[model samples]
Target: MADILLTAVINKFVEIGGNLLFQGGGDLYWFKDDIDWLQREMRHIRAYIDDAKDKATGGDLRVKNLLKDIQELAGDAEDLLDEFLPKFQQSNKCKGAICREFAMQIEKIKKRVDDIDHVRKTYNIIDTSNNNNDCIPLDRRRLFLYAGETEVIGLDDDFNMLQDKLLDQDLPYGVVSIVGMPGLGKTTLAKKLYRHVRDQFECSGLVYVSQQPREREILLDIAKQVGVTEEERKDNLEDNLKSLLKKKRYVILLDDIWDVEIWDYLKLYLPECDSKIGSRIILTSRNSNIGRYVGGGTSLHVLQPLDSKNSFELFTDKIFHFDNNDWANASPNLVNIGRDIVGRCGGIPLAIVVTAGMLRARERTEHAWKRVLERMGHKIHDGCAKVLALSYNDLPIASRPCFLYFGLYPEDHEIRAFDLKNMWIAEKLIVVNSGNRREAEDLAEDVLYDLISRNLIQVAKRTYNGRISSCRIHDLLHSL
Candidate 1:
């Protein structure tokens, strides 16, 4: 992740420098040389990370710890620049003392980079030159989606049960939560149910409330998605939302909620319709406590891992592109190896997806497959966090922090789009060509969508125009 951070920091330095250049102010020239120097230092740090990503995932405690340190330093550098940007924008003409102070800070940042390099060399970390691991691009290009026609083996029964709960017209309103460990398919199951019953209501939408949810923003988003016009969306958003949905039969999916407090806030706006018009709220959470808190009267649905047979089927389908018949074409030795790899996944769907993806590009030989099994042995049994880290490593460096920042929120938190975008902008993680706060926010949104496309993040809710309203980080990814 540090490698990813260093990469982002370098790019940010260049972007800030370019922005300064656009001002064409003589006082800003002082930063030109400093930005160039920071870029150079970042390149030096990049040398140590050539193979750091692979080693970090190799289950070496020492290597992972080292990368954590680098990630922190990179974060510091990012925070510093965030402070610098507004100041720079406010006064392109620097005061004599201010210019000197800015220069000192740049020097300090340079020294920190140098110190990190020295530590990298002391570890004797080798820079490997193999970029041919073509499993998946660390970007949205490799986004995975569960096709509606796709079979989820044991999920059909669970889906049907959930559908009955959601579509039960007997209840005027209720809350149903799907609880499980990270990557156990809670969100997947909810998605299937949401799609199945969404249209049955007068209005419906899925909203993600992550660890650090902003109550007001999420409420605004809910209101917008349920038909609140921009002109009518001002002031007392929650009140407005309640009024709008008071008479309509609606269903809202609150995915990956971390705390009951969030529900306490959102439930106010989601009114209970008349007895004849049943409305419902569906939530997915890792915490059973959350389910208990919001369950109203129904029992919580706990998702168990796939059985061994189902796990192998999922692995084979993913690796073979869902063509189950293709399995016969592979050598028997490879088939045995594939099963062994699936065993290492512990029946987690995300683990199966990532492990199969990692193997998708390897040579289809017993020896090559065995080598992957060896690497899998290093971290496979650890937990979903380790398994999910593979996907995190696959993320392009620029997107890692943007993704990891989601972990900062508590479990089951729904993050607001406005706050999220502003946070990224303040950290200088967003790249905006227009150099305006409004445009920078739009670009930040694109980054969020990129994460969503990669399935690194989940949408909780959307605005009236279909823009994402809130987002969620998987509990496993949050743990990472």
Candidate 2:
């Protein structure tokens, strides 16, 4: 009787692949049990491969061949199970939910495989691969909807200030710095200004120099933005940049700069335009000192958080999908709770977007709103901190402390790369190579660039010497 029951279960699974297992609501628990069995089988297959590798360490050719054959069979079985397991047992009712979960799991598996493959391919695992060399330039021609319609949200007045500086042919060398907290919309404002007046300048370019700012990568980015061919970059990077921008009225936007040294290197390439020929450098940073260092008080625009109405509107757009009527008609208690939740977001656009996304998926009920309000603090922390943490977690373990070290700096404090890297070396966060600390320092900078790219840190400004003079975190983000 037990054997017959087992045979019936196996046949059911084979016949319907478990899709109908829950349909009749009869003994669906066996479906999970069967999937677990397959998982156990995969584990055993992996163990066999490990055993074979250990036994063949003496270079036994026949054993090695036999092990390879067994490994291939195990791999095929694993692959077959992987293909059928989801179809057989997992919930297929919600495509979006299932696909998202599957994608995340697959991504984890892919990263693990890639890491193992990298180890197999290279005898030494160097941290140099963490650099932004793989970073690709965003399409400047494509309009980003993050900014939304200009009529709904008024233009940031700073855009006009940058436009004036960029178009002023009589101004010899002008540097404009847009100072703001993270998600207060520095990049959005810069993009708006760039889109509006990019054509006015003889040459225009925008490069997002994320936290792990690389001079070579930045120069390469500039080269690409201004139409410098791959062949030109193959030649001297600096020389190619100088040749491309010299004597042209150019508007170069160095977005999210972290290292003042980037400014130092970039300045060498920028033409020293006379009063008759103008060149503009617009930068965005969360640190005021960065603004002072980069802009020298001449062209600095400080961005303030939005007012209650704007903040509410931003939140509403994200949560209610711009259906203001639905939100307005919601129960007064529910609406108040929602408003309170938005207030905690501190007018940070990213925070608002993340929080509102969570709320949007939930039912519009008093109980639901209260639940969100009750957990508002934790939610805000996760939203702000986790975005930054994603970049930190992605970093190699060796470079992780280099990032956490930034926590020592007070919120909104400007950080200089030279002093920071030296501190990292002193604290033993950096690794030295061949009596040259350059590689270690370079890696540290890459870590910084990674943070900046992830929007955790903001580039303040570049000094006259062309290095990142300062950096700061958004206050709300820093609180996280």
Candidate 3:
């Protein structure tokens, strides 16, 4: 236990040191130095204590003194960190540096305590032959792609079909399109599939082309997924993409395609598949026409909203997660209200997940759930108008108009790149200089993409040609 605690303390110190150096703009090297010195001192003291324990002849007093000294040093280091942390947090400019330092300091203290516990456990072991403690399993940390407040439910058949298509070696076309209405789990389904089949493929990459589909952005995203690190050099996106795809059987998931031109360009870059290795491309979009165009007469996989039972089950899972199975036991009325709320979500997984998350932290009450259900029902009347209205109301006054202008287009209608830019300019919403219209357009596109990413707008469609043609609001989202 003592050893574990000591290791934990050292680990914490290392973490803080690294965080401070990196997050502080490389201005906190001295903090790292201090941590390093403390780690060395702790290590030496631990070694002396261990040696004294092994040699059990008249060294008890010496060991006790050494342990006291180590405790004093640890406490002093912790005190210093606590004092420094608040000061750094208070200082606007030094906030990042201070946070990094504090986190590292706390982590070190935790590790030391853990080490102490581990040592005690080892010493108390009854059977030396059964020394399983030495064989501690390594922590398997997973890579999680968090789809904020979005749920993928009741699409098992669609998900399986797409999986089969990707796994099929004899399929004529490498590109497969998953078509759906906005907020209908197109991206979520793709994400689920990617995670499932990621290990099967030689290399797999999921690029979120949710922004204004600039060819450069697409290329950069693909390059990053395929492990390209060099930056600042100018090159055509197609050339870069083709280079990344060379000799690799990769799954390139192009999310939110908007224009046909993007498909034309992408088609040129994707390698022609053979028997041994075949590269696959997956696209998600709102426009069935674009999906058909990209699929080249292939069957389009349309994602439907969740059914009532699935919606309730998804909501229940989000809030309860298997612990609170007896919904009838804990506020039955609230459970009924929750069911009502889920029903009002119109089987949309995104709405149910977000609403469930919001309700999770609140008290389970009939009144609360009733109010939420009523609000959701009101919002659904206009296909997310009320929900979006609420969200807009919650936003700072400055960002409201910027959000509402996005609703001028019809549902699943792809707002053009230049058109959105001109609207922002005409509205005087964005600042411009040197009459660089392209730059202004890029900024406007960025703002729109940010809103979409934030769940304010749903990315409806993307073209293989690399354009965002349309966007829509979730039924609940539009209400705001």
For candidate 1, the 10 contiguous residues with the lowest summed lDDT are: 137-146
Over 1-480, each residue of candidate 2 has an lDDT whose tens digit, in order, gives 111122222222333443454455444433455444543433333323333443455565655665554444434434544564465455533255554554455445445434443432343222232334656556331234234534324334556766776566554347777765556677777767766776877887887765556677778877878877888888777787787677577777777655567677777887764434566777876545565666577666777667777788877777767565666668888878878887877667767778888888888888987888788755656655643443444444445555566767886788886788788765545544333568767876776665554455667876798556667766565555
- lDDT, candidate 2, residue 252? 77
Looking at model 1, residue 408 earns an lDDT score of 71
Model 2, backbone clash pairs (residues 3+ apart or across chains), number: 19
lDDT of 2 at 141: 18
Clashes of each: 14, 19, 56
C-alpha local distance difference test of each model = 0.71, 0.60, 0.60
Candidate numbers sorted by TM-score from highest down: 1, 2, 3
lDDT of 3: 0.60
Model 3: residue 166 alpha-carbon error in angstroms:
1.6
Q: Which wins on TM-score, candidate 2 or candidate 3?
A: 2
Selected candidate, larger lDDT, 1 vs 2 = 1
Estimate TM-scores for all models. Answer: 0.52, 0.51, 0.48
Question: What digit string (tens of lDDT, one per residue) describes model 1 on residues 1-480?
Answer: 565467668768767666745456477876787787877777666665746656766777777777777778787887777776677677667677766777788788777777766767776776533244435333321122223433465588899888887776663347677877667787777877887788888888766665456688678767777888786787666667788788788888787776679888777767653356678888887666677778743648878778899898888788888455667788888888889888767667878877787777776789988988888745443445553454455555566668767867887699998899888777666766556778877778877876765456777999999989898875445544
